[model samples]
Target: MDFDKLRESCRKISMPPEMKSRIKTNCKAANADEKQRSRTDGRLVAVCVCCILLLLGIGLTYSGIFERKLPAASDRADASKAENENKFAEILSTAKLTADRIFETTRANIDETEMSSKTQTQSQQSTESTVPEQTTEFVTNPFVFPNGEHAANTGSDDLSYVRPLYLEMSNRENLIIAKEAAETMSQEDFDLFLAENQSMLQGGYFHSMNAGEYLEFTQREWYIPVAPEDMAEICWMYYEPTHEKIDLGMDFSETSKIRFDINETYKADYYYKDSNKYRYEKTIQRDNATIKIYSRRWLYRFENFAWKGYRMDITVCGQEMSAITTEMPLEELEKYLEMIDFVTIKDWLS
Candidate 1:
């Protein structure tokens, strides 16, 4: 058959309504398939969109740009890190505070210990000082009595009780009269001679020829206030004239130029083997604001039996302070006297 005739024959063979219905059914099925395909394409697009959003969220979480619900282990690790950091900071702070406190306490303790040691040392020293030393013996000078009275000399060998001598020097005044009076007396006659002539010498005159006379006469004589007349007599009795006059002496020419600051002067009564009364001198000094007082006594001896002394005191409240004493031969004593303008005269009236 020809191709057109073959197609006509096939169209004639089909059943009419049933075949049409089946055809419609088939067309419907095709349309449904097409709609299904479009819906499937839309669903595929939605699924892709959901996948992209999920991927973006995952990326953000990985980069720490979004909060995430952490697994238990991750949460524990983060918490542990914070705890360790806090612990480290707490330890450092506690250590710093403790070190500061320890340092301060240690410093305070050292200071307290040093102070305690010093105080203990001072107390120990004070305790040691309270006891008197057995080796030290204080022998008070008998002449330097607390009551201001001097002890009398009994001619005993103990001369420690003998008083010291005090003198002041200045320009000459009425010393000529004293010089004349002192020259006239002999060792035996000194007491009477001094008794009569002591009035001629007004300033602190004592008749004696002991070592002190040579000491004083040869050195110098200065004007001092007169003591009691009995004191003068006692001194004259104790001092006797020598067999030969030692010409070595100095003049008391400076008596008027010198000044005096008298602190204290005293006399002590004494007795001898022959019952002749005698006396000794004592002087004392006191301290003032700007000056110190000094005390001394005139001591002279004609013989072992005859001895005499007079008290003298000087103060330097506004002046200088110096003391000197020495022993020399009779020749030197005479020369010292002559140098000081003390001239020996024979005639009492002249």
Candidate 2:
């Protein structure tokens, strides 16, 4: 026999149908066991994986590694964290507010600077465009007096001039003493004396009072009272026009004028009526730029209770001496003249 064939046949004979079925069952059982073992092994691997995941979860929760971040506690770290956040927000807000304020302030400063620059530029331009104002001069007309002795062009609408009346240095006591020594007269006689010197008393041209004259103080018809009341019991007066009016200029605003400076001295002088009476001599010096004129006034009191008025005599004594007479009512001017300052005349001239 062939040993290999024999062995194969023997193996077949030993494997009976029932026995084969049993063997098959045993093999199936063994396969079931293997399957069961594989399932068990898979379950153990799943369990180990689950256990590792659970431990990792536990560790993460305890250590706060993979856990949800906790909120700050109301009484602990959460409150502190919230306060810090609020402070940080406040700081940020303050910073932003500060930045905004700085921006606004800078913008306002720029605007103000621009406005000031514009205003200054406009002012400068206006000043440059404007012109300075010029002063105007006025010229007057020429007028001649009927007397033909004087003429003037005052450089205005009319002839305007001022003349000194009288100057004296005697005191009231001296005046009283002089009044006692002079001649006596009545009020009626004094009135006639004033009427005779009407031209001088009214400060007018000799021609007007003489016969027919056009020159006057206001160039209008104004009259001086013939009889003016007196102030003192007796008083002396002196008045004179130093020189005849001369042609000044058509524009005499800047012109140097003839001014009279009178020096009055109180001394014992012989009067025409009574030599023992006190008399005042006023020496007046008049000057323009080219020449000087001299005039004199001598005053004497006429002692009369009834005729206590002021009597004035004026005369220019270079070539010849002529007496000019005028009178004033000292009584009417007494109140005003008492409070007047003599130096005020110099201030007015200045």
Candidate 3:
């Protein structure tokens, strides 16, 4: 009943052939199913491994850690802040460029404006400089005298229209010279005689005395009588010939008065040792035309007394028509001025 007996018994026990073949077939089918399942499980595991690797690669690229290690929260915040700083710097650069452009544009505009203004000013100045100055024209008129006597209008071309009175005065003998000579001779010779016999000097007039024994002497010989009207005309012609009339176009009215100080007007021409000795003044007015008059006074000191002299100037309108200097009083000088025919002169000026 040992091993030999058990082996013999198992060999002697036989089954049907068809049943054994069926069991073998079932075993074969089961082995084939297990191999296919094992192959499917291995393919699934490989596919899962490939998907996981792909997911890891995508995560690293998106998170910006493909080139470096993943950062912590603080490191990520620092990186983001640095990026923001770079963006801010770029924005500031763009803003600065824009400001520079604006400044350049504004400067160019200002420069253009200044240049234009300067050009306008220079043009105006040039135009003003190119303009010409106005000139006055002078014309001559027929000469007339205050006296009723008119100068003969000679047909000769050599004759001047205006006859100067100075020529006539020069041709005649000077009465002042003869009178001076007589006074000087009386003073030299008969001074004591005249002082003792005051009644012998017929008239107090210096010219009345006989200066010396002359071949011929007559009262009318020393006298060249000139009427007041003729004398005024002569004086006027002497100072200013009728041909030389000034048209200064001065504005005047009946009541208007103009006074000129000779000291101020002719500072360089007048000089005197004594400040109070010599003075000259002029006044002017108009009715239909201007009438100007001036008075000059001078005082001279002698051994015991002071001698005073006066001069008068007359003008019809603005023309210097007459002037006279004498030892006459102010009232007498005024009388001479009043004798002038101003209305006639005003008509001539017009």
Candidate 4:
């Protein structure tokens, strides 16, 4: 692009050796003829050189015009980026404003909930000894499968957290029939029912095992059948305190998680010191409906008292519902199974 350098390069240009030799031979022959012809020959030579210079200048100009006409790749990319921004800027701004509003609303609700919880706790502390509510989310291997739900209050601390899945029905009629059938059994009949089924407590209550170092899911929270309203709650998963390793979301990929999600066969391996009681699998008939159970029982001790605990996963046939019960009255669960008999009284349930 420097004009001075370009002009210098052009000045250095010379005719080819062969062409200069031929031109020199013609000029010598013309000089021998006459001065007029010699001057004419000189002018002819000048015209040839001028034409060569003109052609060279024309070629350089053609190339320079093309080079200036075409845009660069980076220039094209920047133009495309600007066009996209112009098209979506308003839409993006609107979306950001909506997202900020939603976030603020969620934060406000969480703060309000915390305030309510604090007030309730203070009132409880004023009355009697209180087991502080733990809001921390915990997960572990095998039996303590996460329901993928965070409940603000799992349930009453001193009682079982297993709620009948039938109560989860949206229809008012479904709620009434399920609750009534569950409550219909009188205290005597319920005790009789427990005796009939193996619902009686296997171990003592309030007894702490030697394994106090382990965390038990039943002590704080419990698991129940997780399914849609159309499906029955059959399988329950809960953790019992044992001397075994507690895998709290550690080495997840290496650990083969126990999954008995809805509709999957409930066959899984567990361990225990006792070979016989390591696992129990059976199919029993209740209310003329077949029920499959996968269970393991263990005994824990504190001082002289012995507490019996079981990690039982019961699947009610045909209804697709399951439950896991421990340290609580199993009769309450039995009443549930008998109440929601889908095989014989399908119409009644429907």
lDDT of each: 0.34, 0.31, 0.34, 0.34
Candidate 4: residue 226 Cα off by (Å): 13
User: Mind giving the per-residue lDDT tens digits that candidate 1 earns over 99-214?
Assistant: 35433543454445445544544564577753222211111111222234423223332334332221323212234444443355332243233233322232223323222343
Candidate 1: clashing residue pairs, number: 36
Off by over 4 Å in 2: 1-28, 51-59, 62-72, 75-115, 120-350
Whole-structure CA lDDT of model 4: 0.34
Scored by TM-score, the top model is: 4
- lDDT string, candidate 3, 1-350, tens digits: 49999999899988789999999999899999989988999999999999999999898779786566667978876775555455435434543553354335434544553455445445655777432121101010011222322222221122222221110111113333333343454322222222222211211111121222121212111211221222222211111223332211121111111111111211111123333533344443444334333222221110000112332334554564533233334555455444434554443224
Model 3: lDDT of residue 327: 34
lDDT of 2 by residue, 209-244 (tens): 221222222211222211111112112212123323
Count of clashing residue pairs in every prediction = 36, 2, 0, 8
User: How many Å off is the CA of 6 in candidate 3?
Assistant: 22
Those runs of model 4 whose alpha carbons end farther than 4 Å from true positions after fitting are 1-75, 87-92, 133-350
Global Cα RMSD, each model: 44.8, 47.0, 48.1, 28.8
Clashing pairs in 2: 72-78, 73-78
Ranking by lDDT: 4, 1, 3, 2
Off by over 4 Å in 1: 1-20, 31-39, 54-105, 113-350
- For each candidate, what TM-score against the reference? 0.16, 0.20, 0.19, 0.21
Once fitted onto the true fold, the runs of candidate 3 whose alpha carbons sit more than 4 angstroms away are 1-16, 35-350
